[model samples]
Target: MGERPEGPGQGGAEDGTAWSGRAGAQAFAAVDAATDRLLGYPFVFRELSRRIGAGEVLVDYGCGPGKVADEAARRLGARVLGVDTSPEMLALARGSATAVAEYHLVENGRASGLADGCADAVMCNHVLASLPAEEAVLEVFTEIRRLLRPDAPFVLLSTDPACSGTEYASLRIGDPGEVYGPGDELTVRLRRTDGSWQEARNHAWPVGVLPALLERAGFRDVVQHRPTVEEALTVADAGFATGRAWSAERARPPLVITTALATPAPLT
Candidate 1:
């Protein structure tokens, strides 16, 4: 399991967990997150925008340094709450001029100080990769469910582990033909804004198994969508959509967005 909730490399035994200290936090804040920027987060915001309107509460679970949360707040006008297990990350997040409405710490496997069912919607982006077991993932889903009101939407943004070896703009998941089962370790390479690559050790959770897990965690209506470049042409920024050849991504889109609704609470 990952030491703290944030993006990959928050700290672990794999190679070197570079996402520590002020420098590491700054470096993480600077990651290009190319695949995410193009195909991952835009789709998440779109999904949230459809479900909730401006001023509603959106909890960004495992929000690393508040970049994506800030964007969601700015784009959708939601009161974004960023929660992470890492105090360092939360500090970095709070330091951002464009930080979200609030930053909260997650302690002892829960988002401390945030009330139950406080969110209108919740989005967990790439945080599951750090989990190494079904129970861990289920725990995350359960917590997310606890954060939502009855029937609130939970949008999970993840990378498809099967799309390995293919180099998209900024990410390469694993070795070619390397089929990864749930909880299998894999090396993911991410590009920085300055054009350098960094490796992170993460675990795989295939899209097929997520629905069942969500069901077991008190969620319903699980639907998964893989965003493609063709779709991005409509949803993404004009310049970004037409920016690159995006040949690899066009052929095999690695990003997956799983949307589910929290089941209503049982009667007392």
Candidate 2:
């Protein structure tokens, strides 16, 4: 596939560096995110809608540029909060015409100004790909646990690194038949709205390890779903599902949604 390579730290693995500068933020904002649009986000929203009521709080953890957060607020009528570690991304989000209720900067691995248990649910989409290690992944999950009330759901959306090499409608992960272990580096080529492709260096966290990490982070009832095209037709936005034929996506679904409930507070 024809794609362009972004400059250093544009989408590289570094604290506040991935999607760092104004250029990086804008570039990320322009990502087509076909997998997310077709399968990942729709399933997350549906899971959230079943658990939380309108006006309830939903935190969009790792909300780069706030696109999905804004969409969630509008679609679910929820008070959506967009939180990210990158100030540039937050600045870009604030400048956009978005429905996100609030934007907070993540300082010292904690979301500033958001109270503990403030959200009814939280959805972290594609954020795991940027983490460099399992420890970082655990930290993210632990922070999300802190933001949710007991038993509130935490929904995480990520790509299956094992499905590498296949060119999907919007992105391709690594080379064909390439195998990646946890924390291994991989190249992700993402399509933009302008029909251009750009490459980002991302880490692979195998789907198999997520359940144990969630369990350690004060969560329970962990469940995983690999969304299929047939499922997307029913749950995804009609515009996305019908936009084009998802032949590659239909053959091997690459996205995985892992949901877990925050463990209830201990008895007094």
**70-137: candidate 2 lDDT, tens digit per residue:** 88899999999988887888888888737889999888889999998999999888888777888988
Best by TM-score: 1
| Model 2 weakest 10-residue run by lDDT | 1-10
Q: Write the per-residue lDDT of candidate 1 for residues 1-268, one digit (tens) a residue.
A: 1112234335322244646666766766766776777788889999999999999999998887888888899999999999887777788888882748998888877988888889999988988888888898888888888889999999998888989889989878877889999989888877778898777777888889999999989999999999999899889887988989999998999989999999997122
Supply the TM-score for candidate 1: 0.93
RMSD of 2: 4.1
Off by over 4 Å in 2: 1-17, 266-268
